[model samples]
Target: MSLSQQQELRAILEKGLPHAAQPYLLIAQALNTTEAQVLAQIQLWQEDSLIKRFGLVVKHRKLGFKANAMVVWNIADEQVDDVAAQLSSCSEVSLCYRRPRRLPDWPYNLFCMIHGTDREIVTAQIDAMVKKFSLSYVEKDILFSFKAYKQQGARYTKQGI
Candidate 1:
């Protein structure tokens, strides 16, 4: 895409796509371009690794998921990947990732987020996960979320290009 087109795309993305039936078509009209052209450019950008992810950002609380917790586990280094995959497959797990452990203080590495309408439900899901994974002996922690701030897409500027 040309520099001007890139700038326009970035601007549109910063404001986020419209919540309409034909968001891309609306965006195309607003940008004075065809919907197919806009979609082609977006696909090209994805192929070029410019866009890491493209999906809806749901408001969990608004969807009646009031209780959420980040469950961190200190699994063996060799088992982290397998455990992450297992947790990622669970229906209760909203997100799963692996992070380095802060040794001697924080030893947790694998992390998963669980969400539910009630705290007890979240806890029960966590318990089920532990039992299913035979993680009774695994060191873990649950940090519940108390608040959620506003969510927004990344802001890109022409100067940053």
Candidate 2:
């Protein structure tokens, strides 16, 4: 893709997802192009892996999900994939991803999020998950929402948020 096309897509994503009622058509109008063109570019970007994900960024606290926790698992390297797949299929596990362990201090690779109305609920869910999965080497850290920082897509432009 040319620099201009990349810039246009970046702008659209950074400015927030396009409007409903034919959002792609609206974006096409803004770019002075057809909806098909806009869609094609989006598809190409996704194919190239330039677009990681597109979805709502819900502020859990605002939505009454006051309890936030990160459950880290120290599964064997070979078991990581299976554990991740199982964790991802659970509704309580909002987000699940694998990361490299830091060192002797941090031995967990699989990370999952559990959000609920309170810490007790979140803890119970995590405990249930650990028992159900038979995860012996798992550690959980409850993250209280003191404040929420910025949450948005990457903005390649030099403009302000």
Which candidate leads in lDDT? 1
Per-residue CA lDDT of model 1 for 32-61, tens digit only, reads 888898899989889999987777778778
Q: lDDT value for candidate 1?
A: 0.86
The global C-alpha lDDT for each of the candidates, from Candidate 1 onward, is 0.86, 0.78
In model 2, the clashing pairs are: none
Model 2 compared with the native: what TM-score?
0.75
lDDT of 2: 0.78
Candidate 1, number of clashes: 0
Q: What total of clashing residue pairs does each candidate reach? A: 0, 0
How much is the lDDT of residue 3 in candidate 2? 70
Per-residue lDDT over 1-161 for candidate 2, one digit per residue giving the tens place of the 0 to 100 score: 45776687677777776669898888777777788988888898889998777788777787888787877777788989998998898899978999999889888888888888888888888878778888755564555555567655556775423
